[model samples]
Target: MAILDYANPTRFLRLTQIVLPWLTAACLAAFAVGLYMTFFVSPEDYQQGQTVKIMYIHVPAAWLCMMTYSIMAISSLGTLVWKHPLADVSAKAAAPIGAAFTLIALITGSLWGRPMWGTYWEWDARMTSVLVLLIMYLGLIALWRTMEDPIRAGKAAAVLTLVGAINLPIIKFSVEWWNTLHQPASVMRMDGPTIDTSMLVPLFVMAGAATLLFFVLHLQAMRNEILRRRVRAMRLKAAAGSRAARMAPPSSPLSSPMSGTPGAAE
Candidate 1:
């Protein structure tokens, strides 16, 4: 019932308009503080030295890369099960942002890896699984584009998203499961975060900033999607009206003869 209430596109747009400015401001302010903390406050790693700074960006990007997918998967469920009007829009809108975050993670990880691992890339399980996740995001985007009908596309994408979710855990535990070059989880381990408070503070701030930015982007994207659908509907209606007008029989000129109605046939 609550979901249905928000299904109205107009209502959603109205809400977004009211909240978007606030979200934008928050995103900007948080990012500023996060960046400042990341570069200025965080110290160099004992072993990795300056390369450790990349973690500030790489870690948060990695987190959002997974997080965005999780959001889409949940939205997909709403699309497939409840048929919530905005569900597909949310999922669709998130794909590009997820893809971008995934790319940033991959790039920054490679940059950090070169000095530590002596190479930019290795066919490590963690890296490989993350690559697969990126591929899944791209594939979902392609699927959405290839289908003309939004409803059909949404259902198809939802099914694919649910099926591909198996990769999430693989990405998470790949370091632990295999003899990989990738480092094991330090922050999210059974023993709690091994990272010092000095580093953890900036890491948390960056992570929060990234999450806020994702929401801002996602909401704006959904708003655009709703407007696009509205334009499409209007075009279809206009086209249909034109076709109907063309198909209608033309009125006969003789029906209103200038002389007299009684002798119109003559």
Candidate 2:
């Protein structure tokens, strides 16, 4: 009931504003702890040494990139199907943030790879699919911006998002699904996580921190987008009013500015 109730714009605005400050604080605190754990507490990998530290940032970012796209896709579907206003806002808000996360993951993954794999990148199935995911994000953003009709844009973006979602599974299973330079799964295996406890804690903590930060960033971005919409609406309304005023029939005491007074007429 509460979830559906917040579909109202005023309700959402109030609710998000109330929770936003606290969420922001929590994100900052968690990030600090996660950073400390990643840098100081986690043991170095036997093979990669200190460089393995990059995984703390890289893996979580990669996960978020996919997770955010899923969220955006679902939100877009909801906006298109139910015409949920907040759904559109959520999808729009998630795009650039997701794109940024994808870019970070790619850059950090490359940095880690250069040291470990002796190259910056490989044309593996996973790498290519992830690149597709980033382009999908960009495409969604572009489509939304290109259309003036909100509903039309939302529907088009939603369709693109759903189509792109096919890439996510490929990204997830690419190592096993194909012979690739990328490694197979470590934490999520049938036998359970293979990672040692010492390294696992920081990785988990960093993942948690990244998730919190995504939520915080999403909320802030949604607020900004809502404001942008309001500004646009107001501008359009003002312009329409001005146009109407200009087109209105004149109702004046004098017909023209240069109209003569009684003495000048005489």
Candidate 3:
């Protein structure tokens, strides 16, 4: 399978090399369109005024926060179950990026909330759950650093990541499960989007751009990780060789100076 062939790091790197330029172009184009629409075309909320524009980016970042973690969780599964060589690389690369998105969501949410909620923060179910997600991201990153061996680190982090996944559903349903300042889903529903079409269009555009950006970043990070592992292996092999040379006993040749006629053995 084309996808399975990429299980090899070399193949995966080749795929990234070929696709990254196009992905970057598309991502930039989407962002340009999304931003223009957000600033010029989209209407402001009657109640929140221009503050509503924050939703364009806030919503996308929030989605990415969850989506990135989902990727990590799936990659973790790949590591523990499938033994895919690139799985840990994927998972490791996604963690920091996910954390960045989560942080963006929190900051933007706070800025948006101050105008709408009359405060920057509330220890509400939705907000708290997102905070927990950020903490988990940081923890997984630390776990990776704590272990020197990639395989062992990947397995350990994989288990922890899966454990943290329980929080995701809680984060999603928190507003519904409990009374919270965070609003319920507006666009993502079976009944269809509640927002007007004008606003929804740009929102979707922004979300798509954000998703593309994530993949671009993810792929680049994976390539770097694969190369990093290769370098580590080479360094270890060199160290082993040096140690072997040091441990080897020194030997004298049979035709040494002491055995010659000038200094023959007595």
Q: What is the lDDT of residue 116 in candidate 3?
A: 72
Sort every candidate by lDDT, greatest first: 3, 1, 2
- What stretches of model 1 exceed 4 Å from their correct place? 1-7, 170-192, 249-266
Q: Estimate each model's TM-score.
A: 0.84, 0.83, 0.84
lDDT of 2: 0.78
Per residue, candidate 1 scores C-alpha lDDT tens digits across 61-161 of 98899999999999998988887888999999999999999999999988877888778986666566678789999999999999998778989999999
Judge candidate 3 against the unseen true structure and give its global Cα lDDT, from 0 to 1.
Answer: 0.84
The true-versus-predicted C-alpha distance at residue 58 of model 3, in Å, is: 0.3
Report the lDDT of model 1 for residue 206.
86
Off by over 4 Å in 3: 1-7, 170-192, 249-266
Pick out the ten consecutive residues of candidate 2 with the lowest summed lDDT.
183-192
Please give the distance, in angstroms, between residue 124's alpha carbon in candidate 3 and its true position after superposition. Answer: 2.1
Clash number for every model?
0, 0, 0
User: Which window of 10 residues has the lowest lDDT sum in candidate 1?
Assistant: 183-192
